[model samples]
Target: MSQEQHYTFGVSTRAAERLRSLAAVFAPSTEQLLGSLGKVEAGALDLGCGPGYTTELLQAQLSPAWTLGVDSSEHMLELARARCGPKLDFALHDVSRLPFPAPPAELVYARFLVTHLREPVQLLRAWSTLMQPAGRLVLEETAFMRSEHPAFQHYYAYLAQLQAHYGQNMLVGATLGTLCEAAGQHVLDAGVRVREIPAAQMAALHAANLPTWSQDPYARAAFDAAQLRQLGETLREIAAGAALAPAVSVGMGYVIATARPPALVQG
Candidate 1:
C-alpha cells in the first residue's frame, strides 16, 4: 500500500521501530491470546507484523515449526528480518488484497490492522480461508482512547477526521467480536483491557506516532502546519515533564478478540 493510502501511519524506519516499542505495552495480552489458541501446530502468521515484535513474542510462546510475518513495507521487513530468526520469515505483500501467497496457517494474529480497512468484514472472511480447519484467529484493537492533555486531545480529534477521510476507523476494536461472528468464526473469548500510562510513556508513544500522523498529506490538508508544529512541541514538553499539562494519565482501551473456524457438521 502506498504511504498515501495508509494515512494513519507510515512504514518509515523510525515508525517501524517505534511501532515495536508500542507493541511492548500489549505483550501480556498478546501472550494470553496465543495461549487461548490451545495447542498449536503447523505454523502461525502475524499479519501486519511491523518490526516482528509480535512475531518474536509468538516464537517464544507457541514456538511453531514455522512462523511468517507479512507486511507491505519493505523497510519494515528489513528490520523484521534483523530481529527474527530463520524460523520466523517475513513476506512483502499488501494485506488489503486477498489470497496470501503462502501456506495456510493454523494460528493467525492481527493487531491494529482491521481499522484501516473500509470493509473489515470482507477482510475477515478472506482471513478465515487462510486458516486451517479449526484454526484460531486472535486480534487486538483499540475501542477508545482519550487524554486529558489539551494538545494531545486536539491532535487526536483531527487525527480521527483524517482517518475518516481515508475510510478508516479509529475505534473499530469496539465491534471486533461481532465482525468475527459475521465471518462465521465461533467466538472463543473476547474482552477489553485498559491501560493507564504515565505522562512520560504517553509522551514517548505519541512522540513516535504524532510525527507519522501529522506528516501525512491528508493530515496536512486537514490542519495548518502551525497547528501540527505546536502539537509536536507540546508532545516534547510532556515527554520532558516540563509542561504544566493536566497530571491525568493517558487512558486507552484495548479489546482482544479470539475466535476459531467452525468445525464441519457431521452426518
Candidate 2:
C-alpha cells in the first residue's frame, strides 16, 4: 500500500517490539464497549473496519445483535463481509457519508480511524447524526508518548527517519484528547492504556498491515525500497535483542465520545 492509499508499511518499529511481550497489559476499546453495554445491546458501527478483525471480535462478544463494519475501501469491505457474512454486516461506506440502514446507532466506534483522517472531527460529527442520544462513540488510538525502553531508541530513530520521507503522519501518533474534546460529548471519557502483542502476534500484525501500507496509492510515492529494507533490518535487530519487556507500554488509549441529541460542539 502506497502512502496515497492511506496506509503505512509498518506502524512503529520500536512499539511493535514492546507490544508483543505485553499484549494483555493494555486496554482494548472492544472491552470498554462490552463494559458499557452491560446486558442490553443494540447496534455497532466500526469505522475503518479493515479485514473485520475487530468486527469479528465484536461479533463473538455481541451476538444476536448485529454489527456493521464500514470502510471506504471496497476490497476491504468485500473481505470483511466475506469473513463475517451477513450475520455480521459490512459496507463500503465513507465515514463522512455513512450509508447505514438506520440513521443513528446505539454505538458508533472507530479504532485507529481518527489518526488516519486529516479532519476526523467532521467525520465524528457526522456519526453524531447516526448515534442515538447518550450513545457511545469510542475512538481508540495508539499514543506515542515516549518509549523508555533502552533498545527502542535506535529503532524509533530509524522509524522517524523513514516517516520523514514516507509521510509525517504515517503512524497517526498524535493528540487524541484534543480530537475527542473537539468532537464533544456531554461526558468526554478518555484514558491511555498500554498493551502488548507478543512477538508471534506482532509478526502477524506486520503480515496483515504491511501489504496495506505498501500498496497505498498515494503514500507510497515517498517510500523507497532501500529505505524500507533498512527499516526491516533495524526492526529485526531490535526484535531479536534481549529478554524483552514483560509488557511494552504502547499508547493504546481509548477516547470515548458519547452522543447528545442536540449535540455539544457547534459546526
Candidate 3:
C-alpha cells in the first residue's frame, strides 16, 4: 500500500497539535513503562516517534547514552528534529520495514504503532534484528475503549472500521503477548493498564483527530457528512467544557519482552 493509504491520520498542523495533547495525556503511563527498563547502555529507539515527544520522555526517564526517533513522515521528523535538537537524533524511515538506517539499540519502544501495521508478529520479529541479543522491546497499544457517551462510542466505532479497512487492528493490544511469543521473544511482562480519561481530555483528542480522517475514503463511505459534522460539534463542545459527558475507560495494553539469545555453536 502507498504511504498515504498506510496511515489514515494526516500529518497536518492540526494533527501535530493533536500529538502534543496525546503526549501529555499518555506521558505518565509511558514514563512508567520506560522506568521499568532500569538502565540502557546503548540507547533507545522510539519507533513511530511523532514530534519527538516520546523520545524526550525516554531521554528524561532512562538517560540513555543516545536516542533515535524514527517515523515515516518527513514533516513529523522535521518537527521531531526541531523539538529534540542535536541532543537526540531523528530518522525518516517506515518503521514497518526492516533494516532500519540506525544501528542496534538496547531498547526499542513503540507506542500506539503496531495497530497501524499488518502482521504484527512479523513486524515484531523484524524489530528483534534491530536490537541487541538481550535488548528489550516495549510496546503500548489500545486493547479496547468504552464510554457511556454516544458521541465517543460512535467515534470509536467508525475509527475502528476505518482502521480495519487498511488492514490494521484498532484493538491489537489484547494479543500483544501472543505476538511477542510468536516472534521468538522471551516475554517479560504483559498486561492491560486501565485509565479513566476525563470527557474533556478525550473529547479534545477526538476533536483534533476528526478533521484529519473525516474525509478518508473509508470514513466518507461509511459515515454521512451531516453525521460527522454533528460528531465534530459535540466533540468540540465537550473539549471546550461547554458540554458534559461520562469519563472514557481506556484499556492500554503494554508488553515488555527481550530478544532470545543466539544459539550456541560447537565445532
Candidate 4:
C-alpha cells in the first residue's frame, strides 16, 4: 500500500457516516473518565487523525474546545476534511515531525496511530513540549493476537506478517500510561476496552483490499502471489471457523496524561 492508497482501508464513506456514532466507541467514555480528573483546556490537537472520524467527534464532544487534525497522507487528509463539517482544522503532517505554529497545545489526542510508530518516544517528547501546565496528551492503539485460530493459524499468520511488512507500527505494550510515565509525563489514568469487530467485517476488509491500504504505491509494492493466496486462505478460515477468539477490537485509552514541561518534571 503506497502512502497514496491509504484511504482504501476500513468502512465506506456512507458507512463511515452511519457508524460515525460507533466512532465514539473509545474517546467518549475516556473523556468522561478524564473529565472527573479535571477539565481540558481550550484547544486540542488530534494527532494522526487519519480520516477525521475522531476529529469530528472531538469537536462535538469537547465543544468549546477547539481541535486540529494532522495526518501524513494528503489523500487521507482530504477524506477527513470531507467527512468533517468545518468545526475543526485539518493539516497534512508527518507524526515524526509535527507542524504546529505557536508552541504546543492544551490537549493532544491520537487513536490507533502510535502503535504503528517506531520512534513513539520521539512523538511523546515532541507532543509533551506542546503542552502548557496541566495540559494532557491522550493516545490509543490496537493490538491483535494471531494465535486465536488453530484451523486457520497459517492463514492469519501470513496476514499478520503482511500487515507488519506493510510498515504497520507494532506497539505491543506502548499504551499511553506506559509510554507517558516513561516519557516523564504524569500518568493521569488509562484503561482498555475489548470489543468485537466481527469476523465477517474482517473478511470484507480483506476482500476490498485497497491499494493505499497495502502501501503498494511506493515502487515495487505488489504482494507476491504466494502472499495473496495465503491472505485468501486466511480470510476463508476466519469466515468458516467457529469461536475465533482473536480480540476482534480493543482500544487502549491514554486519554489525559497531564502535560508538564520536562524542565518542570526534572526539578
Q: Against the true structure, whose TM-score is highest?
A: 3
TM-score of 3: 0.94
Model 3 residue 124 CA deviation in Å: 0.9
- The candidate, 1 or 4, that scores higher on lDDT is 1
Instruction: Determine the C-alpha RMSD for candidate 4 after optimal superposition of all C-alphas.
Output: 5.5
Writing each residue's lDDT as its tens digit, candidate 2 over 193-235 gives 6555454334333333334445554435655656655555544
Model 1: per-residue lDDT, tens digit, 1-267?
A: 123336377888778767866887667767776666666778889888888988888878888888899988888888889877576799997776766867888888888787776767767877877777767788887777667778768766876787788888887877887888887667766666666656655666676776776567777676787877787788888878887555433323333333353445221
Q: 110 in model 2: Cα distance from truth in Å?
A: 1.0
- What tens digits encode model 3's per-residue C-alpha lDDT throughout 1-267? 123327777888788889999999999888887887788988799999989999999899988889999999999999998888899999999877767998889999999789988777878988988887778899999998899999999999988988888988999998899999999887889999899989999999988878877668778777788988899999999999999998999999999988783342111
State candidate 4's TM-score.
0.70
* Model 2 misplaced stretches (Cα beyond 4 Å): 1-5, 9-29, 36-40, 62-64, 98-102, 145-174, 196-225, 236-247, 261-267
Clashes of 2: 26
State TM-scores per candidate.
Answer: 0.88, 0.69, 0.94, 0.70
Cα RMSD, each candidate: 3.0, 6.1, 2.5, 5.5
Backbone clashes per model, in order? 0, 26, 0, 11
The digit string of per-residue lDDT tens for model 4 on 1-267 reads 013222223444543443343454454554554455445557878877767877775666666356888877776677887777676689877667645653566777777677556546656777777776657777766544233544335434544454456454444333667777677777766766555555644553443442233444432254465566565566655655533535344344444576665456567
- Could you tell me the lDDT of residue 42 within candidate 3? 82
Better of 2 and 3 by TM-score: 3
